[model samples]
Target: MKNLKESLKRRFSESNGGNEVRSPLRVLLRKEVAEHIRSWRFIILLTLIVLTFIASMYSSLSNIKSAFVATDNSSTSFFYLKLLTLTDDSIPAFHIFLSFLAPILGISLGFDAVNSENNNGSLIRLMAQPLYRDNLILAKFLAPLLIVAILFFSLTFLIVGYAMCISGIPIEWQEVVRILAFNGMTVLYVGFWLSIAVLLSIRFRQPATSALTAIGIWLFFTVFFQVVINIAIKAFIPDPNYLSADKIAYYNEVILNILRISPSQLYVDASTTLLMPMVRSLGPVSMEQMAGAIPSSISLRNSLMLVWPQLSGLIAFTLLLFAVSYALFMRREIRS
Candidate 1:
């Protein structure tokens, strides 16, 4: 008890005028972020990211070079070009790479964010400090988001560098800014998923269970949900062969709205629109393509705005999950 009192007094003295100077939340956030960076997991994640990017660049370099060679002419100089013209195929490759890999990176970095601390008993020690119980959860959440931002930027730089080197062209300011904007959106999208992982970590005391839960949820949303949603839509809409054109249009709009509920699908739809010039679908597209595919339903800005609802939904879901964990932690009794 004496030690506890002295510790409290010292903590108070270090605080600002009886109020905590550095919130426990901030400390926890910083500590978690630093720990993540220093850990082998983070290093492995970075290594994988670099490796994947290198592989992608290598695989696509031949095609990109061929395209450049085909287009190379005395009249059209690679220099003095204001923008790197993105072919439809180029855009799809980015989407494919991000979709398959970004979530893995996010989940790996964050699925253990809180559960590990709890398992190691550091969480109890952390709460003993002059910090609110919920601060640790909040910090865990913030740490993954920061890491997401950093990884996204690093990827953006690498992609741009590769593009410049392969094209043997100077990247324009506008192109750089556009790439940054796309990457910024991607970071937020990926961070939203990481928040879900954080929420799972907080909910499960066992790190392995928490990670498995996160992965399960990801698979359901990305893979199973997609199938279920498509089937439901198809069953209800049923080709609309007997419907009027206006009715068909209305049905299509409704289906689209419903589909956008899944962020991954929203990401696919939006990215396709945003980078239509650079994107290409790998699987067999419907007859709609051969017949001159309908242009994207929304422009890039509009598509972005449209995705805000889904984004908000994801963020709110994460926050709600974290809040529940925070409340539980606050009520928990730490045994000496």
Candidate 2:
């Protein structure tokens, strides 16, 4: 702790004295990036996710080969993306595996962000510097986010490149665009988890408590949420078979809406839509609505339009969590 403070103090002093200058936020961000890169949590998370990507890609290649042999057609569309979406009996799709594990990256980076420093009393010392008060939290939050984004985006390129090599299929430009959007949405989904973890850090004084709280919430949504949803639905009707056709449709709609309340569900809905342009709709469709509908996969624009509300909900929730975090942090007294 002593050495860290001395180093930071010396760095800040030297920067101010030198002819070259940098913004405080940039300096803080760089420092944080270095710390995160060296942290054991970051290393473990990186290794875990990399191994997942490899396993997923291997499975996808095998599936694509089998699918190709089974079909007479040699021209397969969106072949590169199947690297992320296609799964064999052994391994699941790349995005499906990612959807389950990606939040851990955010959780690993942010679970200790504020409270750990406060517990060590270093946060107070860091704030004693000439930098604006908000800069600390702002830089802390953004640095991890930027680094996580780069990490995941790089992994995306690796999967796509490998899938290209194995499949020997040419990817369309539009498909490339859609995959890029998929990568971006994946990052955003992880960012939402990171934001709330930071908020929890503000609310809880113990790093362990904040971490456990975040993981608890995550588990509830990922593991038990749908179970609870199904239970609620069953409890309501007792016997879904007794419902009329119109009632069944309404019941399905209610279930879908409730499931979207979970971040995991929203990510799945949005990521699948983005990666698999063949997906036409995420919600209930009336007979009239589907009467004139084309059987083919929809365009990227159409897919985006269909999932815009889900995307918006994810973004809004992230911003709302960050806003609450900032408010709570700003209200906290350093003496406490």
Candidate 3:
């Protein structure tokens, strides 16, 4: 700890003496990123994610051969995307695995962001330096977010590269665009959880409490929330067995809307739409609306339009949590 403080002080002194000046936020951000990278928890989390990626990729590769054999040339349109969205029963698709694991990663990175420093008495000492409270908060948030972006993007490109090597097929421009969009959505999804973890870190003094709270919220949304929704629908909504077609469609829409309240659902919806171009709608579509619609895959523009609401919801939720965390941290009293 003494060595780290000395290094940071030296860097600041050197920067001040040189022609180049470093912003306090940048210096703090670098410190945060370096600390996270070096932490044992981060190492464990990264190993877990990499192992899952290997399993998912193996499943995807094994299925890809059969998938190619079964599909005609026209149906093989998004072959590269299949590498990401395809999987056997034993393991979920890469994107699906990401949907489940990424939140945990984000939460692990951020659940102790503020409280741990405060508990260790570093928060007060750090604040005593020539740093604004906002810069510290922003560095705490942005550092993890930046690390997440790099990790996700690196894994995504690795998948792309591996798929190309095995399949010997050049990826389409549209597929590239779609994959990039999926990566961006994933980063945002993880950022949403990161924000929640940060919020809890600020709210709770004990890091353990905040960590468990974040995990509990994750479990509810990932597993039990859907169960709760199903029970509510069964209790309130009329049984679909005797409902008219229009009523059934409306009922399904209601269920979907309620489910979309969970960030996991939103991410699944947006990612499915982006990766699978055949998906035309997120909600139930009546026969009348589908009567003239062709079964062909939609264009990238149209797919984005289809999932724009889900994407917007993710962005809005993430920003809202960060804003609340910012407000709380600014008003917080840090005593030496």
Q: Model 2: C-alpha RMSD to truth?
A: 3.2
- Model 1 over residues 1-336: C-alpha lDDT tens digits? 234335555656677853574554555676778788899998898887887667655545545655455446423332211122233453436556787677787788778876787787776666666666666666776787788788777765776676677567665443454466556656766766777777677677788897888788778878898689778887777567788766776676676666666767755654453443323432234455548754422233554454455556656765666666667666766654
What global local distance difference test value does model 2 have? 0.81
Q: For candidate 1, what is the total of clashing residue pairs?
A: 4
lDDT of 3: 0.88
Highest TM-score, which number? 3
Candidate 2 at residue 222, lDDT? 94
Q: Write the per-residue lDDT of candidate 2 for residues 1-336, one digit (tens) a residue.
A: 454456566667677554224456666787789889898877888898789877976787678776455333434366666556767768777888888877887887898898888998888878876566677788878998898888888888887787678767777897788878888888888889999899989899998899999999999999999999898878876476677777878888989999999999999999889887777888887797879776666777899998898899999999999888888888889863
Q: Better model by TM-score, 1 or 3? A: 3
Task: Quote model 1's TM-score.
Answer: 0.74
- lDDT: the better of candidates 1 and 3: 3
> Cα miss at 71, model 3 (Å)?
5.5
List the candidate 3 regions with Cα displacement exceeding 4 Å: 1-22
lDDT for residue 30 in candidate 1, whole number 0-100: 61
lDDT of 1 at 238: 58
